[model samples]
Target chain A: MIFTIVVVGGVIGAIFFIKPVPKYYTRYGVELGTNVQITYATSKGNAKQVVDEMFKKFSDYEEIFDPWLVGSELYNLNHSDGKWTKVSPVLLTVIKDSIDFSKLTDGKFDPTVGRLIPLWGFNTDNTRNWHLPSPKEIKDALKHVGYQNVEIRGDEVRLLNGVWLDLNGMMEGYIAQMLVEMAKKNDPNSTGFVDIGGTIGIIGPKNGNEPWIVGIQDPRGNPNQAIAYVKLYSGYVGTSGDYERYIIVDGKRYYHIFDPKTGYSNDYLESVTTVSTRSIYSDGFGVFSMVAGEKAMKEMAQKIGVAYYAINENGQVIKSANWNEYEYKK
Target chain B: MNTKNKFFSKWDLLLIVFLVAGLGIWIGIKQFSPPAAKAVILLDGKVYKVIPLDKNAYYKIYRGDTYLMTVETKPGAIRATYSTNWIFPQTETTQVSVATGWISKEGETIISVPNKIVIYTEGSKERTLYDAMTYQN
Candidate 1:
């Protein structure tokens, strides 16, 4: 009788706790930006429809596939040429948010490094290419990269100079936020996750139960590995890496995550991943912390009220004072 | 047909109705549900399929060409690489490996093997590992 009770109890536990087996799942896919796929799954009525509408409402491609058009318009506005051109509310909003990040990081987080891409030949496909920028060139770029250059009035915007804005740092995070908002609309009691360009956002736990497990990507792309897994309950995460962009030559390494001051990559750290309530903060600070290094990161984490985990150039792990609070499976 | 054998009481009718409805949904899910999102992993000058089994079921895994793994997916996790003899894994190569949850001192994914790494990208196939290199732009 005791053995029977044990077997029955075990069966009941599995039935009640484990994710339902042989359960039905539906997925919807939509491509945005450099090709992002948002998948929505539920075994209920019209799961795919909800995801489809969500995609329609949110996209960072700036109207269409024409990057050059968006780039030129945004650059003209962000630079000293904002006195002209009709600025979209979307661009204005993102610029404002980026400005807030720059202030929060004390200029450590900047968005004006747009031309850096073309300079490195990332604008088009040319593998055998890379040109190091001189300090003077970097200084010139810096003049155009500050957040203050972007001025926004009631409904208009003004650019301080010929500055260009690169929203790549926060674009993914913004998409993630939109996904979470969409998920909440369908079921007041549901679990959802969205990842756009490595920026991950979540809406509650999985299936109205259990926390969502999010893995932080290793900047080095070592393979079959993860730096950390933090259980998320409606929050944001972002990663910046020295390994994010680089060039190899004669067995040497050079990356593109540049410093506004040096006109070259920040060397103090290797990778920085941050988690916070806001995706902008997470994404911006993730890059900010990498450029700022460990000492500055301690202060950055406190300033933003978030948790951070970073890897140094020599392979060292350092977390902000509050990192333990958010680490789930560490 | 025999009348008595074919006839059903109200209680029996209710039970059958419930069972049929429940089973219909279950079977429908098994039958008409859309195919899993496909991702073409570019690695070693070839494309491999990555079936991301995201526990949350809402994360879509993308490769070089299209979707690599669907969200809310729970595919089997790879604790370790299952390859015996391997080949060269270069910058644009791709591979499908599970999160052993293993990390390095620098906290990057450590794929000790060549075939274990795959890159996912856009336009150019193998998006995942394709852009892994650190381009100090």
Candidate 2:
């Protein structure tokens, strides 16, 4: 009877003794349909003040640092007379990064393809409208999609031809990373994670003492089954998939991630997720790996320092060497 | 104390448990978990072989005995991957000095070994193998 009482007492003790993780939220709805979300997990720390400061610094959509709103500036720059404009500093850096990616990918992922996106009517909203791009139409848009057309002179930016720059792929991941870093800067003990769209960034730790576990959406969410999941912490996780944007034809489907060579979406792989220290590298490499397909991805990852995992159409998981070391759940 | 007060007063007991658990985890993490390895596999340096696949589950065996890592094949051996080191010395674009050429001396240029991944050209008599690529244990 005494032992039973002690056991019961121990059970109660375990529950009461644990320190509850505290969660704080900071969110702002910016202009131009842009939104930012930041979450901070603390043991005994408060991050409200720090997070507010970060939001204020990053909230100026019209300023020289915001990357998301700069797409509008690039849009206007290409439409104006052939002259340079004092563009956002962050946008200038983003364009430089995109041009670098275009060179690295051999024109595979060109950011200057802004003219091509609206032509497909994807800029507004696209879930149903899918059509074949006529040869004449594609040729006209292709003229304005080269990386060499955009010139970056220090803080100023210029468009050589009528070309637009779109940082949609790089912006969300960068913004998520920026917010996480800003929170950590004020409170060294800040332990939290941010998930935007499919991109994920973790600042300190997940369980305050453990690596944060992230769930990857299964490409096929019919009855809501996870195709596969990965564990990510202290890094950025970016997933580019065929499911994001696609065109479904008679008994078949097509997607947005295009291969520049044939001007069509790839047929080999379904999704590719990359993890890296830099959010930019994670964003660029995630899309590049999908475009490179299975065989090429392995070779590139071996050469590059970034780690990644890929999911093929068959739902099989292909992981880089140390994937098992990180605690991954389905 | 009432039954409700008895439960509520358990904070004193809980505080001790919390500190002990937190300290245990803190010491455990600092004591046990090694830093994340930069180069996933280090070869031609310190030699450590995994005789058992149970504990050393995170290492890939390239060569030698210490780190004996193998792929999970229900029926057989692994099908060589591009990034992995292979038995058929890869001389592809990524692997520069890997030789597809067979060196011969005594009896013949090539010979076939059953139960092993074989290599041979058209009308060739023998197969050659120096190594095999393996996954982390």
Candidate 3:
């Protein structure tokens, strides 16, 4: 009888002591042309304030980064008519990082391919009418597609030969990093995550023990299905996949990750996902790997000291040596 | 008499076994249970509506009664149809065919960005693909 009472008391104590931590989630739709979802665990219950501030910061960054927006700093720089244009520090930093990535990937990840984006109708929201650009048009766009054409001296950026800069490839990751920082700043002890589109950055570990599990979308599967999952404790994960935005014509798929060499979408990869300590590198490398293919992606992952998972056009999944370490096994 | 010999008595072992069994059963129920079928609609970031997935019904969603779209829910599945919203500032109309496909699984989302509408299915077993997903615009 005493033993039964002790066991009952122990069970009751365990149930009370092991209370589940409350987690707050805020989902904001249609911010910066994509959805933003933030999840945080904090005793202060200030998730709404943190998310509001993050969205406000996103608005500020969009004004600086959006090249198509008429009043954006990038738009002004693009229309500067071969003259040196003073840019914001954020723009300058991202541009410099873009150029560095361009060089690092041997122009596989060029920001100057902005001219080619519209030539193939990728810049337009109307993808229904998207078509292949004429060879002449592609050739003409190619003339302006070189990262070297961008001249940056301090805060002033100049486009030699009228090369337009598109930071779309790297902007979301940067914004995600900023949002994560905002979450941490709002409450240092808080644990959370920020997902802008598909680029993700963790503010800290979830539930204070288990790493955050993220699913990699299957290129051929339905929107909700993941080919696999990766566990993130902190840092960022960015995926570039043709399946997300693509035009199908005559059984051929054309998506927006452009190859500066051909002024067309690279046909090598279906998707590439990069995990890195820094959001910028994760964004840049994911795009780079999509264009560079499997062998180069593996080498780059090793050289850059980041984890990567790539799916080829044949739908074969490839992973870096360390990628399995981050896999969330059921 | 050494106290170590009495440290794990039959009662202690029985208690541990019961605790472990209870935890296993809880985890099993949590992981393997089929999620409750429901479709959550969000308009401009707030929950616009939540429809049960167990019944056949058609719901007309509107932005101030403008009749933006119709959502069809069947037993265990949901889909969007009859959308007339423009695809942003561009010339193309929002294609209902793209949004018309049935979404029954967890984590599946149907989004019409131009209309500021998002529809996602949820269940107890529906797991998020990632803590967050980042993709190109």
Candidate 4:
């Protein structure tokens, strides 16, 4: 009786004295043409204020990055008529980064497909506006879609030929990383995440210790269901799939992520997810993989040292060797 | 001195019995009396409305006079049935949210990004397995 009493009393004491979990504050909304969620718990106060500030950054950056938005920096640059136009530091940084990625992937993830986007009617938010372009139209747009045509001297950028720049591929991850940097600067011990669209950047580890488990959405499954899970203690994860912003005509799906050479959405893969230490790679690799197919994806992963998990057109799961490190099997 | 008397007097025995009974009752209440789940709807990142998923009902979401979406709720589950873009109501752009069907689990969400609407559940006993999710942008 004494032993039982002691044991029960000790158990009750332990349960009562266990460390309390931190309360996480979450904010969700639409920004940068997609859903944005910011969740965090900080030892320092003013978490809500900081999160609102982060959301404001999205609209500010969208004005510069969104090519379709009239009077946006990119819009003005696109219509500069071959003259050197001075660009903002942020715009110049992303443009230079995009050019490097284009060279790295051998034009697999070119940002100069701005002409092709509007031709396919994907430049607008309303799906009613989306339509299949004729073969002649595609051919015409492909002529003006080349990353090498962009000439940058100093802080000024010049578009050669009729090429236009679309920075959508890496813009979300860049913004997410910027938000993460802000969180870290405000509080080093902050624990939270910044999700811009589907690309995610960890502000810090979960509760300052555990890895945050992130689910990867199934390409052909329900919106809330996840086909796989990844454990992210830090860094970023992003997915590019053919499911969103797609229009089906005669059972043929014409989605956004266009191929520069062919000026059509590639049918190589259904979805490609990448986990990387760099924000740009997390966002860009999926676009690169979607266009380049499986063999090129393997080669690109090797060259860039990023982990990828992909589902092919036939619904086969393929992943890189390093992907196992971040994959949560359960 | 008797061993039983020395170890636990009548008062000690009664104290032990009281504590055990209290602990059992606490555990029973925790295990059996689960709280009702609630669905939180947000418009533009602000709380628009909150509905308890304890009855069958429909909620029409509108921004001022412009109808945006309709939310359906049953006992312990909620879903978006008909959602349209505020700008282009005639043309059904994408039915991803409506096609998502019912989301009953806590942390499950149905999002209409163009409409700037989000609906998610909370206070369910079965928590979501993952902390976050990644999908096509």
Candidate 5:
């Protein structure tokens, strides 16, 4: 009888150790005018339902953030005609964050270039609809392009001198952080990531312990290719490249990322990838680096305490010394 | 000797063997025989179809009677041939999806944002080097 009891106890302990690993599930969708891919592992077996709710949240936020969409909160704010209009919490928060980032980058990355987006005919997705605007047109749009023109009092915001705002610089990172938060809220033990366009946020470590390896695309290479890779266990990684949207004219490539001062795309860098503890920094730093060039990029990275990797227009790769912390060498 | 004082009896030994064998089988199936490579296509956040990457074929995709694009699949890779956007019908597209070329790796994806379509491969024999990729938006 004693021997039997010992055997039974041992068998029970073995069974506890043999619990199955959580299965990984990846779901894809389109939201915020970009592709959304989420991969998660949940031991509770509610992964599908949790992901469905996450997509629903993405769709809801897309309309609120889309600057070009008619009837959107941002659209109403842009067309407010210099009057202080009460804004939604989401819009107010983004605008506040935009201003803060603008100050941080010293206007290198500005969201008030909304007028230039259409002036260069880049407001539409169709490449055929895009064209090089006349010098006068760009000059006129630059007249209304300055982050300082935005005024916020309590919950009300007014665009001075008809300066429109475009939050694409930091929108993806903001949404990615929200999705990761939702994932952890649903299941605290969950491990996964949310990728909106190219901005990625970690819900948790891969398989609850391992880092999620992320690849940075080669700016001049094919879309499916990667020039380098990074290991991320938490936080976010964002890349800004000139190849994403561009037009070639007179043997010169002009992209969509506009310089607030020049009213033309910045061409100093081909790509800029940043890793930050905050998603907004991860997303916005690349935009800052693109317009600011290498010297300013180095200063900004040190000041903001973020890691970065960049390839210049001449195909020279540069990285902050701290980037060594996240490099994934295979 | 009394049987009660023994560390293990014949039945106890047999039970241990049965338990160990069951655990071994479970691990083998879970680790060794992973599913074959296949492409998962989504339309407007829904699972439109799943096509195994074992043969050469072209799959035409549509949304509510509107023809969108055609996906070409070969033995180990897949790509979108062409896509049309109704919103800018007259304007030529950048053909970003078609420009992506063949995606044979497990984690690579092809996306047509205007059409609300996404395609990604899974279950390759070799694990993907990266879980996700970053690019300029």
Candidate 6:
């Protein structure tokens, strides 16, 4: 009887003590004019299905948010010509959030600079065709470039000054947030992340113990190179840099991140990366820091309670007071 | 001598051996299995192909019959080569070079936005520096 009990105990221990390792699934696709990658860990083997549904949701959101797309909600609103356009609630929410960010950054992160984008030939297909807009054109475009010109009531949005709303900066973060929420809803126990372009939203911790390691792109190096790595368990990370979409004219590099005040690309900083509990804040603050430069970035980051890392034109690395806390030591 | 018997009998020893052997085999299988390695290629956000990294091979990636580039692979490594396609009116090539050559260890990638192609390695043991690389718009 003693022998039989010992054998049964051993069998039960063998069966019950071993835990199945969680399987990781990664899916990649292009949406919203950039690469979208979703990586998640789940023991139930439903990551692919979950990610597929998320991508479909992303497409629906893109149609509402993408201004450059001809029939998109924002596109229709932009071409509405002083009329109050009925927009999707998602668009309304994003526009409202963008205006708040503009106010927070003192118009440094204006989405109303949509007119300037085309003037700089950013809307065109070929970067070789991109040129500096004439001062007269710049002045004319700047006339319509103020976030205060936007008015929203219920689901109707109007550009009061005939200004266009460009939600590019804020939309990525919002989408990231939405994807994170979807992932959590699908399986709260699953761990993973959603990366829309460079805007990243964390689902949860890796294997419930290890934090996700995110690398900051080196401003002077290739796309795959990293200057530093940040360890994060949750929240969002967004980066704006001069290297990605820039044209060199007469030895001067002109990037796409524009300053509302100057009506041109800001050259004060090479790159700015922001980390926040909210993805929209990360996205907005990154663009704000790029336009506002290092000193203002520090001040704004402090006021808004976000961590930031900035690389100046002189290649000097600047970090917020709490920035080092996120750095991965090993 | 005829009346004597051991408290710890042969049956106990047999049970202990069986348990120990079973646990050792289970642990060995869990820890020693080699992870499968593969190169995942994405074209415009969708998985274009997944190629095993264990063999030598060559693949020419194209978008709608327009030849983009060729990727050469060796055991456990991959590289991009001979991209003859021009990016529209620009004089620059597609600018996807693995000329620094051969990304074998996982997490390394070769990407060309103009061609909308991305190639990266994936494996169980592989670690990546970033969850994703963000570029300036």
Model 2's DockQ score: 0.01
The better-scoring model by DockQ among 2 and 4 is: 4
For this target, which candidate reaches the highest DockQ against the unseen true structure?
Answer: 4
Error of 1 at B61 (Å): 18
lDDT of 5 at A244: 59
Better candidate by DockQ, 4 or 6? 4
Rank candidates by lDDT, best first: 4, 5, 6, 3, 1, 2
lDDT of 4 by residue, A14-98 (tens): 9999765667888888877788889988878788888888888877898899899899999999988889999999899889999
Residues A1-330 of candidate 5: C-alpha lDDT, one tens digit per residue: 466787778879888987566688888888888888899888765898888888888757867888888988898889989999998887788889989999888898999999999876778776667778899999999999999999999999999999999999988998898889888888888999999998999988877788999999988777778899999999999999888577777667788899899998888999999999988888799998899999999998899899999999889999999989999999
User: How well is each residue in A219-307 modelled by candidate 2, as lDDT tens digits?
Assistant: 65421123444555588777777763455555455565656554566766676777777787667776676667887777766666677
RMSD of 5: 4.1
Question: Backbone clashes in each candidate structure, one number apiece?
Answer: 48, 10, 11, 0, 0, 3
Error of 4 at B93 (Å): 6.9
Which is superior by lDDT, 3 or 5? 5
Compared with the true structure, what per-residue lDDT tens digits does model 6 show for residues B44-115? Answer: 777888988877889988888988779998767778875653332332212435432677666567765556
Stretches > 4 Å off in candidate 6: A1-15, A43-45, A124-126, B1-36, B54-58, B82-102, B134-137
Query: Which window of ten consecutive residues has the lowest lDDT sum in model 5 chain A?
Result: A120-129
DockQ ranking, best first: 4, 5, 6, 3, 1, 2
Cα error, candidate 4, residue A217 (Å): 0.7
lDDT of 3 by residue, A56-170 (tens): 7867887898788898898899889889889887888889989998999889889998888777766755555456788999998899889999998878989999899999878
Q: Against the true structure, what is each candidate's TM-score?
A: 0.65, 0.61, 0.84, 0.93, 0.88, 0.85
True contacts kept of each: 0.03, 0.00, 0.40, 0.67, 0.70, 0.37
True lDDT of residue A122, candidate 5: 77
Give lDDT tens digits, candidate 6, residues A214-262. 8887888766678888888999998988876666666677778888988
| Interface DockQ of each model | 0.06, 0.01, 0.28, 0.54, 0.46, 0.35
| Rank order (by TM-score, best first) | 4, 5, 6, 3, 1, 2
Q: Scored by Cα lDDT, where does model 1 land?
A: 0.55
TM-score of chain A of 3: 0.93
Candidate 2 docking: what grade? incorrect
Question: What's the distance in Å from true for residue A182, model 2?
Answer: 1.4
